[model samples]
Target: MIEHTVKAFDADIGQLRGLISQMGGLAEDAIAQAMLALQRVDRDHADRVRADDKAIDAIEAEVERLAVRIIALRAPMANDLREVVAALKIAGVVERIGDYAKNIAKRVPLIESEQRIEPVSTLPAMARMASEMVRDALDAFAARDADAAVRVCESDSALDDFYDSIFRTLVTYMVENPKTISQVAHLLFVAKNLERIGDHATNVAEMVYFAATGTQMAERERSARSL
Candidate 1:
């Protein structure tokens, strides 16, 4: 009976991890599709991205249910408890990331410009970096890899640099082309969304590191110092 209980508990944890993986994949795809829609100024594609956010949100709800069940029934302790709690927190973060992507997608139709501005061209790279961080953070969580999580945290700096450059360029463009300010402002919000996605990804990495090592990530302290 004890052996059977142990196996069941492990299976429950496995299922939770699987759900997180699925949710992460959907969130990552949302970011990618949002960027693609932005790049092409495709309102239809952007609408699809916005619609897809519901799927991610549904999975997050499922994860929450499963995680609560595991904690209540198995009464997980130590590493197991940390892992369950991390899943709950990470699911919330991933869902927020999906919302950020949806926010970016919603801006697509609002942006009115005859041609893609110079700053608009630079956003895709930033989005790509943010998406990669989300992917790597999930991978780290799955593998219980604290080092990999730390690496994910480190990558956020580059994403920040991308946002900074795009922000400067957009401000300069707005100053030079006063008429385009309305359109360019949407792009600024898009850049800000991507930057927030990066931050959420880093938050997931921090939770993963804590789950894997039972300690908060040192990078978080360093980041606080810098701020």
Candidate 2:
């Protein structure tokens, strides 16, 4: 009977993992498509991204439901309990990431209205970096790879640096040509959204580390916290 219970517990854990992975895929696609829409100033594409966020939101709800059910039924202990909680937490973070992508897509028409657009050069690069981190962080979580999680934490600094660089450039553009300040400011918000996505990905990595090792990721996790 004990062996049967252990097997059932493992199956529940697998279900939790599968749900998170499916949600991760939706979030990943949303980020990628939203950035593409922003880069091209395509409102149609942006609208699709906005619509897709609802699907991701639905998946998050399911992840939470499965995670909660597992906790009640399996009575998971120690590392197992950590893994279940991490799934819940990561689902929330991924849902917020989808929100950011939706926000970015909503900014599309504003960017499209510019008569003489300055290429939102830095925004795409930042989005790409953030999107990659999101993907890799989810992969680490699925694999329960503490080392990969630490690497994701380490990688956030680069995303921050990209944000800084773009911010400086936009400030200079606004100062030099006061007339474009409005558009430039909007671009800054987009950059900020991308930066926050990177932060959330780092949070996932931290959770992954803790779930896998049954210990805090320690000072190393804090190294990129401010970023």
Candidate 3:
């Protein structure tokens, strides 16, 4: 009876992980579609990305349900509890990332009215970096690999670098061409959204590290910090 109960508990954790993976995929799709809409000025694509965020939101609700059920039924101890909580927290973070993508898409119309600028290249490149961080962060969570999670944390700095460059470029343009200020402001918001997505991905990575190792990554990295 005990063995069977343990197996069932394992199954519940597996289901939770599976749901997170699905949510991660949907979040990644939203980012891609939002960026594509930005790059090409496609309203249809932006609308689709905005609509698709609902799916991720729904999956987040399911994750919360499973985590609560497992806690009440399994009475999971220590590591098991960590995983259930991690799934719940990660789901929330993923949903927020999806929201950021929707916000990015929402700005597409304003971008459409603006004249083309050469530095528009920077925004898409920033989106690509943010998307990759989201993908790898979720992959690390699925694998429960603390090393992979640490890598994701490291990648956040690079994404920030990308965001900084885009910010500087956009501000320079806004200063030089007062007429484009409205559109530049929209693009700035879009860049902020992508930067925020990367942040959420990093948050997920930290949760994954704790779920897998029972250690907060921040403490570990601080111990290894260079002067």
Candidate 4:
């Protein structure tokens, strides 16, 4: 009976990990499609991405249910408890990442055909950075590497700077070319979506830090803020 219980617990963790990977793949594809839609002004691709968002949302709900069940039924302790807790938090970030992708898809149609603003120069790079961060955070969780997760959190500052730079450039475009206001505004929202995606990655990294080391990076952030 003890052996059976151990096996079942392990199996639950494995299943949760598999679900995390599947959701990650879906998110990656959604971001890719969003970028393609932007660059090519492909409304069809954007629409498809938007349509697929429901599946990601459903998966998130399912993961949450499973995680809750594992906690209640198995009464996981120690590392098992940490793993289940991390799963719940990571699932929320994954869901938000999907929402960001949907936001990008929604923006594609608004700016489909217009004189592209210079603010766009920063967006692709930001999207790439965010996607990379998400992938790295997942890898960190898989390996339970606290250091790698810290790196992901530290990397978020660069993305923040990128977002600020784009914001300034977009405002400049709107000020200089009132005619391009609508197009530049849409670009701003797209950039915001990408920035939010970076935030989601940072959230994942934070969860990983806690899961692996039982330490909250927020303490450091709070100290810095107080200072």
lDDT of each: 0.93, 0.87, 0.89, 0.86
User: How many residue pairs collide in each prediction?
Assistant: 0, 0, 0, 0
lDDT of 1 by residue, 2-121 (tens): 899899999999999999999999999999899898888899999999999999999999999999999999999999999999999999999999999999999989885686677788
Worst lDDT 10-window in candidate 4? 112-121
lDDT of 3 by residue, 1-227 (tens): 99999999989989999999999899888888888898898999899998888899889999999999999999999888988899999999999999999998999887776478556678888888898898898899888899999998899889888889889999999999998888889988988998999989888999999999998897556856853
Q: List model 2 lDDT by residue over 37-122, tens digit each.
A: 88788999999999988898888898888888888888889989999999999999999999998998998888666465564866
Least accurate 10 contiguous residues by lDDT in model 2: 112-121
Question: lDDT: which candidate is best?
Answer: 1
Residue 65 lDDT in candidate 1: 97
Better-scoring candidate (TM-score), 1 or 4:
1
Which residue runs of candidate 4 sit more than 4 Å off their true CA positions?
A: 218-227
lDDT per residue as tens, model 4, 1-227: 99999999989898888788788888988998898888877899999999999888888888899999999999999877998989888988898899899888888778855566566666788888989999889888888888999899889899999999989989998999998888889888888888888888988988888898877886557967999
Checking candidate 3 for backbone clashes, the offending pairs are none
Model 3 residue 205 CA deviation (Å) reads: 0.9
> In angstroms, how far off is 206's CA in candidate 3?
0.8
Cα miss at 178, model 1 (Å)?
Answer: 1.1
